[model samples]
Target: MEVIRNLVQSLVIIIILAMFLEMLLPAGQMRAYVKMVMGLLVIIAVIQAVGSMARWSFEEIPALVAGTGDGGGQLPEILEAGKRISARQQELGIEQYRQGLAQQVTALVKLNQGLPLLDVEVSVESDSGSPDFGQVKEIILTVSDNPKQTSPAPGGTEPVEEVSPVTVQIGSSETPEREEAVPPQAAAGIVDVLTNFYNIQPEQVIIIYR
Candidate 1:
C-alpha cells in the first residue's frame, strides 16, 4: 500500500512539473524533442516504481534520470542543435525583411521620377538581445544617369561602355564641372521622403551616384 501511494504521488508530481516546463519552453522544433524526453522520463519513473514493487533491480534508471549515461549526454547536444536551428530561422527571417524593405524604399524613391534609383540596400540590427533588434540601421540608394544594361549575352558577359576622361586646367579660375546623376534638390527630397516614411534619421539614408 505504501509503495502504491508513493508511485501515484510521484507520477502526479512529474506530470505537473512537465506541464509547467512545457509552458516555459520556447516554440520550435526543440519543443517536440523536449516533450519526448519528458515522456520518456515519466515512463522510466513508472518502470522503476513497478520494479521496486516486484523486488526487481533496474540500476540504469537512476543513471538515465541523473543524465550520467551515454544516452543522457545527448540532451545537451539536442539543446545546442535547437539553438542553432532557431538562430538560422532568425537569420532567414531578417534577410526576407531586409529584401522587402528595400523593395518598398525603391518604390517610394521611384515616385519622384527625377532621381534614377538603380538599387537600394538596407541594413538591420540582428542582435536579438538589443533593444533596437530587427530595426533598420542604414539604407543606401544607388543612382545612375545611365543605368547599366543587364541584357544577357551568348558569352555570359556584358559589354562595358568606355567613358572619356575630362580635361582639368592646372590653374583654372572657374570651378571645375561636376557631374551628378541626382541633383541636390532631388537627392534632398529623396532623403526627406525616406526619413519621414521610415521614421529614421537623414544620416541613416545615403545616396550614391554611379
Candidate 2:
C-alpha cells in the first residue's frame, strides 16, 4: 500500500515539475515532441512499476510487446514511431536515387555539341519494382548552347542574342520528338542547327526564345 502511494506521489510530482518547466520554453513542434517524450516516459514508469509488483519474467516481454498478453499497453506507441521512421527513410532514399540518375544523364548529355543540359527529367514506368536504370520510361532534356563569338553591328551597338530553349522528349513515343517555341525575338539559328544536325523535321523542333 505504501509503495502504491509513493508511486502516485512521484507521478504527480513529475507532472507538476514538467508543467512548470515546459511553460519556460516556447511552444510549437518542440513542445509537442516534449509532451510525446514525457508520455512515453510515463508509460515506461507505470509498466516497470506494475511488472515489478507482478514478478514478470523476461520471457513474457515478447508476448507483451505483441499485445497478446495483458501488459501490452506500450505497443501502439512503439508501432507509431516505427512507421514514421520508415516513411522518412524511404523518402530520402528515393530522392537520392533520382538525383544520382539525373547527374549521370547530365554528364552524358554534355558530350553532345559541348552544350549544357540545363535539366533532365526522368519517369519510371513501373509503380512497383526495385529502383534501377532499366525501369526508366522516358527522359526529357532541356538542352542549351554555350555563348558564341558575336560582333558589333554597323551602328556600334551589339545585337542581343535570343535564347532558344529546345525541349527534347526521348523514349516517350514510337519516335522521339523535339519541340521549340519561338520567342518574340526568334533565334532560328539554334533551331535550324538542331533540326539539320539531327536530320529531324523542322516542326519536330520547338524554339522558345527569351
Candidate 3:
C-alpha cells in the first residue's frame, strides 16, 4: 500500500515538473525535443517504480531505452530483408504478367485457323526504373506448316522413303545451307493482327516455322 502511494505521488510530481519546464521553453524544435525527453523520463520512472515493486533488477533499462542492444545492430539486416522481399515480389509479378501476355498472344494467333501455332514466347522489360518497365519487348511465335498427306488405300500402310546420306568434300566450294523462309504472305496476317492489337511494331512480332 505504501509503495503504491509513493509511486502515485512520484508520477504526479514528475507530471507537474514537466508542465512547468514546458511552459518556460520557447516554441521551437528544441521545445519538441524537450517534450520527447520528458515523456521518456516519465516512462522510465514508471518502469523503475514497477521494477522496485516486483523486486526485479533493471540494470539494463537505460541500454534498452537507448536502443543500444540487438535492436540497433539488427536495423541494417531488417532493411536488407525488406529489399529482398520487394525484389522477389517484383520478379513474381513480372513472371505472371509475361505468362498472361503469352496466353493472350496465343489466343489472338489461334483466331487465324490457317496458321498452326506451336508455342508463344513473350519478352518484357524487367527493370523497374526504366520508362518501358513491364512493357512487352517482343513476341516470338513458333508455327508449323500443315502438310497435306494422302491417305493409305483401304487398309494398306504407306511405304516409307529411304534417305541416302551424301559424303562432303573438305575443300569443295559449296554454299552454306540456310533455314527455310516463311512466305511473307503466309505470316503477314499474323503480324498485322499482333501489331494492331498490341500497339507494337510488325518487326517486334517474330514468326518461326518448323
Candidate 4:
C-alpha cells in the first residue's frame, strides 16, 4: 500500500512537471486545460505530503488516541512500581535482587523471540562480606538439537535412536541431590533476565550447562 501511494505521488509530480514544460513551449488550447488540472493536482499532492509529514491528518487521530489510551493511568503505576523496586534494592544494598530482576527481564525477551527454556538461566544470592555484593547461584537451561526417535527396520523390529531434549540445571553450591526439574516458564524467565543484564537480544543466546 505504501509503495502504491509513493508511485502515485511520483506520477502526480511527473504529470505536473510535464504540464509546466508544455506550457513553456508553443502549445494548443488542450494543453491549457491539462496544465490547469495538473497544477491543481500538484497543490493537492503537496498538501497531502505536508499533512502526512506533520501527522496532522484527521484520520490518524484515532490511532494516536488508541496508542495513548491503552495504558491510561496504568503507565504511571507501572513506572512507580519499577522505581520503588529500584530504590529499595539500592537502599538495602541488595545486588542479588537486582540480578534476579535482570534475569527475569532476559527470560521475557527470550520468550518473545520464541527461544526454548533450555537456553536460559537464573542466578540469585545473598550478600556476604560486602554490604552490597552477594554470592550467586546460577540455574542454567540449554536446548539440545538432537532428539531420540524410533524408526522401522528393514527386516522386522524397530530401531531406536537417542535424541536430546532441552535441559535445565542449577549451578552453584548446594547442587540438587539429584537433577532438579525446572518449570518451562521459570526457565524462560531466567533467560529473559540474563538477556536484559547483558543488553543482548535473547534469540542470540546459547547457554552451556556445567
Between candidates 2 and 3, the one scoring higher on lDDT is: 3
Off by over 4 Å in 2: 1-73, 124-134, 145-210
Ranking by TM-score: 1, 3, 2, 4
Q: State the displacement of the C-alpha of residue 141, model 4, in Å, after optimal TM-score superposition.
A: 7.3
The backbone clash count of each candidate, in order, is 0, 7, 0, 18
- lDDT score of model 4? 0.52
Model 4 quality (TM-score): 0.24
lDDT of 3 by residue, 83-180 (tens): 77789899999999999999898778667634656678999999999999988899998875432222233467863433435667899899567434
Q: Stretches of candidate 3 above 4 Å error?
A: 1-73, 147-183
Looking at model 1, the pairs that clash are none
TM-score of each prediction: 0.52, 0.33, 0.49, 0.24
Q: Each candidate: RMSD to true structure?
A: 16.9, 19.8, 17.1, 16.5
The model with the greater TM-score, 1 or 3, is: 1
Q: Model 1, range 10-50, lDDT digits (tens) per residue?
A: 77887787788779876988988888887888789778767
**Residues forming the 10-long window of minimal summed lDDT in candidate 2:** 145-154
**What is the TM-score of candidate 1?**
0.52
lDDT (10s digit) by residue, model 2, range 1-210: 665676677678767866776677657678778777777876787676666645554545545444456545466755765566666777676667666665665554444333333456654433335564334444455644333313233367755556656567776665534343322233344345544554455554443212
